[model samples]
Target: MESIARQSVKMCPFMQRAGSVQGLQVLHNANLPAVARKCPVVGHAMSRAYATASGTGARRATAPEPKAGSANEMVANHATQESLFDYDGLFETEIEKKRLDKSYRFFNNINRLAKEFPKAHRDLEDDKVTVWCSNDYLALSKNQQVIDVMKKTLDKYGAGAGGTRNIAGHNRHALKLEAEVAALHKKEGALVFSSCYVANDAVLSLLGQKIKDLVIFSDELNHASMIVGIKHANTTKHIFRHNDYDQLEEMLQMYPRSTPKLIAFESVYSMSGSVADIDRICTLAEKYGALTFLDEVHAVGLYGPHGAGVAEHCDFEAHRLAGIKSLPDKSVMDRVDMITGTLGKSFGTVGGYVAASQRLIDWFRSYAPGFIFTTSLPPSVMAGAAEAIRYQRSHLELRQLQQLHTGYVKQGMKELGIPVIPNPSHIVPVLVGNPDLTKQASDLLMKNHKIYVQAINFPTVARGTERLRITPTPDHTDDLSDILLDAVDDVFNELQLPRVRDWESQGGILGVGESDFVEQSNLWTEEQLSLSNNQLNPNVSDPVLGNLEVSSGIKV
Candidate 1:
C-alpha cells in the first residue's frame, strides 16, 4: 500500500506548489483539456491549490501562464504594463539618477599598446595618448618575457581554461601561478580566482557564513569587494574608521577572545594612497584573538624586497636577508592570516588570488564557491602571471624606479601649486574638490596634452572630494613628468580650479591645502631606495615551493 501511495504521488500531475513553477504549469495547461479542469485533480493543479512549504500564495510577478507571465514573456511584453512590475522602467530610473548626479560612468575607448607601455590610442590607432592613470604599477604589462610566455602558452593550450579548476581547467599554469603567488607573499598556500574582487568576496563571505556568530571588523576605506563580502556574510560586522586600530580594538573587546573575528583591511587604500600600520594592526589582531585579512591588491608587485607588498615591506630587512622561508617568528607577512591580492596590477595578468597558511587556503579552496565553481583563468594568463611574478621577484629596480618617478611627479605638482593629496606610497591623487571640474580636467589633459588621467569622483570618493588620480610608471621619465605637470597647471588655470593655495585659503579639505598637512616620507626610504636589484636575496630567484604542491587540490 505504501509503495502504491508513493507511486500515485509521483504520477499525479497537480500544481506542485505555486505559479512560480510556470514551466510545469505551462506543460500541464497546454495538455489538459478545458473539461479536465472540471476534474478535482486537474482543477487543483490548474488553481495551484497545493500548499507550499513557505505557506504563501504570493508568486513572482514574472512567472506563470495563468496571470503572472514567465520571465521571457514579461521581457518580451515589456512595452506594455501587462506584467505585475515595470522591470525595465526600474532599471532606467536608476540609470537616470546616475546621470543627474554627475556620476554617470562613461567608458572611454582607450586601447593600450603593450609594446609602447603607457602609450595607448583613443578610438583611432593614430590618436595616441599617454595613460597616466593605469594601475599597472610596475609597467610589467609590457614586459617582453611575460608576453613571450603567454604567447607560447596560448599556442600550446588554446584560449579558455577548459572549465573550472576542479575540472579540465586545472593545469601546470594554475599550479605554477599559485605557487608563485604563495611564494610572493611568503605564505604556505594560495588560491587563484577570476579576480581579487572575487577572492576577497569569497574568502570573507565564506568565513562569515561558515563560522557561527562570526564578526567581521572592516575598515571604512576597504574596497567594495570586501564590503560586498561582508554584506553577504550576513553576520555581525563592525565598521571601524579607516586604519583606526583603537576603534577596532574597542569593537573586538566586545567579543570574547575566543570568539571568531576577522579584520579586513587594505595595505594601501588606492584612492588616498594612505599606508596602513600593518604591524600595529597585527598586534591588535593577536591581542583580540582575531584573524587579519589584508587586501594587498594595490600594494603587491610594488612594495617589499621581492614585490610581496606592504606586509612583507613591514619587515623589509628580514624578507630581504632570507628568502620567503627563514623569516623571524611572526614577521608582518607571517602574521597576516590571509593576504588577498591581484595579478592584474603589477603582475600584469588577469586574475586574483589569496595566499595564506596551507590549512586556511585549503578550507577556502574547498568551500569558497568563487574558487570552486568559477571558471579558472586561462592557461596563458596563468603562465604570464606566474612569469610576471617570478620576473618581478628578482628585479627590485622596477619598484625603485616606480617610486622615483612618483616622487618626481609629486615634486613637480608641488612646485606648480597643484593640490596633491600627500601620501607615503607611489599614488599621486590631485584634489579637484568638484566632480564636474575633475572630469573637465581629465578631458582637457587628454584633448590638449594627449595625457589620459581618469577623473576620480563619487561614489568612488565622498562628494566634494573629487580628484584627478595619476599613477606614474617607472618608464614615465622626468621629461614626461614635466610635460604632465605643465599641462595640469595650465588646465587648472584655464578652468579656474582651486590650486593648493586656493584651498589653503578656503580652509583645507582632506589634507589638501591644509596648513598642517604633514608630509609623509616615501614608503621606500632613501637608504632602501639607494640599494639595487643586486642586493635582493638570491633565494628570491630560486623557486621556494613552500606549501604549493602539498596543499593544492589541483594536483598538477
Candidate 2:
C-alpha cells in the first residue's frame, strides 16, 4: 500500500524512468485496481513534465516504444527468460576440475574372498590383479574359526538386530564382545558403536557439549570423524601441529590449571605412517592436568604384547627391557583416560568401541544419540568379532610375520631406488609428487603388471603429497615381494619419478641402518612374547581352535 512516488524514489534511475507507463501497465495486468488508482497522481505529474511544445499549445507526450530487433527490445526479452535451475552444477564442476587435474578417484572393482588372503587375486575385467593396499592387516576376516562362529550365530539369530538397543536390539554376543574389548584395553568398561567413526563422533560431541567450560586440544591431523564431533559440539578447540609436543604445551599453558581440557590424538597417522610420541604426550597431559583421549584404530591388533595397541606395547617394552617384575608406576595406557579403536581393520569385523571408566561409558551409553538411536550390530558380527579378537590376542606368529614382511618390503624398495616415505610404523608409502604421475603409475602397475595399489590424492592428503600406500602382509612371499618391487621400479622409471638419495652415502631422511632394522624385527619377536607372558593369562585357550604353541621363533 506504499505510494507510487515513494516507490519511485527507492528504485534505480532506469527503473524510475520506465515505471511511469510500465509500472501502471503491470498493475493493470495484475488486477491491482487499488494500486493503479493510487498511481494516477504520479503518472499525471510525470506526463506533465514530459509534455512537448506544439503549434497550438503545449501537449502531453507519449513515450516511444522500443523497436523490434533493437538492443533495448532484446534486453527486455532476455530479462523475461526463465533462469537455469542447476542444483547439480557444483558437483559437476568439482568432478570436471578433478578430471582436469588427474586427481579423480576411480574405484577398481575387486572381487575376492578374504580366506584366499594375501594369495587371493582380485578379479578384474579379464585378469586377476595382485592387491597391495588393504587395511585387513592379518586377513582375520577369512579365518575359518571366525567364519564358523559367524555362520552358527547367523543360523540361530537370523539377520538384522530387530530394533535399537533401547528397544530390545541388544544381543548377548555384543555384551560378550564388549567385555572382551574392555579386558583387551585393560579398562574398567567399554561401549560398542556401529563403527569407530560413529563412536568418535558421538563421544566427542557429547563430552564437548555437556562438560562445563570444556576446551578441546586436538591434533591438526586428527581423523574426519573426530573433526565432525568436535565441530558439532561447537566448543572452543585448539589444534596443535601434528605430533608437536612443544606447540601443545604452549597452548595448554595459555589456559588456567582449573580449566577442563581434553587432549585428543591418534596412535598412528594412517597416511604418513608416523607414530605419535605417546609417552611424551602423556607426560604433558599429566603436567597440564588434562584428560587424554587416544585413538588406536590403526595400531590395535598390530602393536603391544597382546595386540592391545602402542600404548600397552611401549609400557611392556619399558618393563621387560628393564627386567622388572611389575609394570612401571604408570604406563602410557594407564595415563590415558579413554581409548577408541575399530574392529574392521585388524579384527576383520565391523564395529568400533570406546574403552574407559564405567561412569564415562555409562554416560555415553545413556546420552550419545548416535548410539542410542541406531540399531546394534547383528549377533553374527559380534560373535565373529569376539572370536577374531580372541584368536589374535594369543597368536604372536601372525604379528611377527607381518612385521618381518614390512621390514623386508621397505628394505627391498630402498634397494631398488624407490622413494619410500620414512616412518617407524609398519606402513610403507611410495612418494609420487604429481597427481597425474601418481595415477599413471597406479594404472601402469595394474594394467601392465597386474598389481593393484590405489593412488591416494587430495583431500586425503595435500595436493603435492599424493602417493601409493602399501601394506605388506604375511601372505606376500619373497618372490611376490621381488615382483612388486620390480614392477614399482619399472613404473618409476617409466614416469621418471625422483628417488630419495641412498642412505649409506648421502645420509638421507631415513638414516636407519641394517643393525637397527634387525633389532626392531627382534623386538617384535622374542621380546614381545616375553613381555606378553607377564600380563596375559597363560592358561586361557580357545576350545574350538585349541592352544597355539609359540616354539617356532619369528621367521620371515
Pick the lDDT winner. Answer: 1
Give the Å shift of residue 108 in candidate 1: 1.3
Please provide, for model 2 over 1-556, each residue's C-alpha lDDT reduced to its tens digit, 9 standing for 90 to 100.
2356447546735436646566545434443322322355654653444453232465534335455335553222222222446869988998999899877889887764565555435543445777788888877888899999999999999988887778875667877787778767867678888999999999999988899888999998899989998898789999999888999999999999889889999998898888788888888888988888899999898887567888877876553343212344766787789999999998988999999877787778778998899888889998999899888877766777778788889999888878777777778888876788888899999889988899989878888778999997767778888999999999988888767643334343332322233222322555553443334444334523311111111124
Report the C-alpha displacement of residue 96, candidate 2, in angstroms: 1.7
Per-model lDDT: 0.84, 0.76
The deviation in Å at residue 256 for candidate 2 is: 0.3
Runs with alpha carbons beyond 4 Å of true place in candidate 2: 1-85, 119-126, 317-329, 502-526, 529-556
Each model's backbone clash number: 1, 0
RMSD of 2: 11.0
Positional deviation of 332 in candidate 1, in angstroms? 0.8
Which pairs of residues collide in candidate 2? Answer: none
Each model's RMSD to truth, in Å? 9.1, 11.0
Q: Per-residue CA lDDT of candidate 1, range 9-66, in tens?
A: 4565443232334434444344333324445766567446423422487542423333
TM-score of each prediction = 0.85, 0.79
Candidate 1 matches the true fold with a TM-score of 0.85
